[model samples]
Target: VLFPGVSIDECEAFTLAFRQLSLSGLADCQVVGVGAVRGEVVGIGGRRDVEQTFAETTRPDVVLVPGGIGVDRTAHDEALLSWLRHVEPSCQWMAASSTGTVVVAAAGLLADRPAATHWLAGAKLAEFGSAASPERIVEVGHVVTCHGRISAMDVALLMILRLTNRQIAEQVRIDLERAHEQAAVARPSWWKRAVALVRPAPRGPVRPRNEQLDTSDWVEMELTAEPSSTTPNGDF
Candidate 1:
């Protein structure tokens, strides 16, 4: 479910990934939006109407909380935190993105656990008992947290892998990548040019060698390669 001031990109990443799975017959799942009330919740880029309120919704298999500027207010919301505390135990997974981790932490669900959050919010997260991790994604037991907005895609893909098989997850990844490429091609000329300017130049194809290296040659190459520097304490 989404909260007010949600990150549209993060919200869509989870929703769309699951929608794709259902559409492809890879899983039987439904995505629902729940709000404090039965109405619209304004998001960063857009607005979404929730079908159910906190009281109307049932327990879900997975729960996602996405971060945005609105989290500043939501983090302290006693009602929402109460609701989260109510639903957390029976959930198969509890995931949060960016500052959304703050909300989850505030709910008292992350005590003494390692979680990922926006780098800037690490100190704030620590106030709630979770050790903020530097990694892009951190999973502890059933809780998963991602470091930034874009990592929502990674979270979705990981969920797909968990809910289905690796093969199905791979297919979904390929489909998403292809769709992204198509969308890039459809962008306006100026936008495309701006992206092209920032994009790294494609590497040239490697040429195949006619001769194969023998075991002795491999050993010699490894021995001649520059030795890695070691620290004073003897750690590499």
Candidate 2:
């Protein structure tokens, strides 16, 4: 875990849930955070506290990044990026959720690689030199990226499979009551489907809201500002 102080929620969720699963004998691994603080603090407990006191270390077997709105803070942080660059060599497996790929991309780690991210931030990944796709989960080389919250279960299952084997993945899936909903469709000619793993859905607009104007629509705010054109008297 690369715990950026800015990514408290993502780090906390991934760490706690991962520890629980690991402790339950789902997987054999240990969780460590890089760039954490020194002692404990309340409110932001466990992983948050761990990350707060995280000491920098070389990469391990796998590195995972969880998804949250906080990814923007991690993606642009230079110190965190520097750490990732330094540890890239020792790391073998890498994973990220949601816009967390933004940080991976910003680190220049996704060049010429396929990655997954929230649809809203896919274009941003492209701008950072990654070939972003609508896939719910994408894995290219040692890097894995997924739509985080929306595809957490799928990503976790996939990681379990890769880390252990299909037997573990199947058993965990049964425990979690998740059926593998993955399928392969013909890739579009124009779009390279190298690592695209989309969560196909019925094509159409979903959950159309027949919203009439609500009372809140009548509320508006007026702002006091200078006029578009300056008055000759400077007071009009």
Candidate 3:
């Protein structure tokens, strides 16, 4: 929910990526936020929707709690904690960014889960049995956490992965030019751009095979093909 000192950058990244669901092929997906009360303008200029109070908002399949200096106060808010516990059963996954982990951990959904939060609060999270990590993003089962606002973009992408498929997730990467971010991690053989199809992606629409094909195109294609007898050890 919107509150004083909410990480404006993180919220913006998350909200924008979520809204791209339609372009990513999840037209039905939704991403919205609420506040402790309706019509409240949070610190640094964030406003919750009209009449969108936490108590009035329906249970959500996914929840994202952002963090900032003010989140320190929320971490110890019993009333909010109680409300989160009350709605816990209905959540498909729960997430937090920056110091927001402190608040979400207070709700009891993070037991035995690995999580990450702003480096400044990394040690503080240890008290909650979260097995905190220094990584930018941590995921275990239905819980996701991001270290700080710097990782907000990656966090948003992870959220998309949870809500959709890899193809759609890859699309977001392309749109955001983040494919290199996952370069060190294992991915499908077909995922690397170096081996992408001869046809280009969205920036240049894929051309129809027959649009310029001539009878000799078949012979030209065969000339570029690897011989069927090519060996496993690079022998041709």
Q: Estimate each model's TM-score.
A: 0.75, 0.60, 0.66
Runs off by more than 4 Å, candidate 1:
185-236
Higher-TM-score candidate among 2 and 3? 3
Worst 10 residues of 2 by lDDT: 213-222
Model 1's lDDT to the true fold?
A: 0.72
In terms of TM-score, how similar is model 2 to the real structure? Answer: 0.60
In model 2, how large is the Cα lDDT of residue 76?
A: 78
TM-score of 3: 0.66
lDDT of candidate 1 at residue 80, scale 0 to 100: 85
| Alpha carbon lDDT of each predicted model | 0.72, 0.55, 0.62
Question: Which ranges of candidate 3 are over 4 A from the true structure?
Answer: 23-25, 44-51, 176-236
lDDT of 2: 0.55
Q: Model 2 has how many clashing residue pairs? A: 6
Candidate order by lDDT, decreasing, is 1, 3, 2
Compose the digit string of candidate 1's lDDT tens values, residues 1-236.
67778877678865676676777666677888877888888898789888878887658777888888866688898878988898899877788988999999999999888788888888878888887887878888888898755566667666666655556666766666576567545645787678768984465523432111101232223234454353111100
TM-score of model number 1: 0.75
Cα displacement (angstroms), candidate 1, residue 215, comes to 38
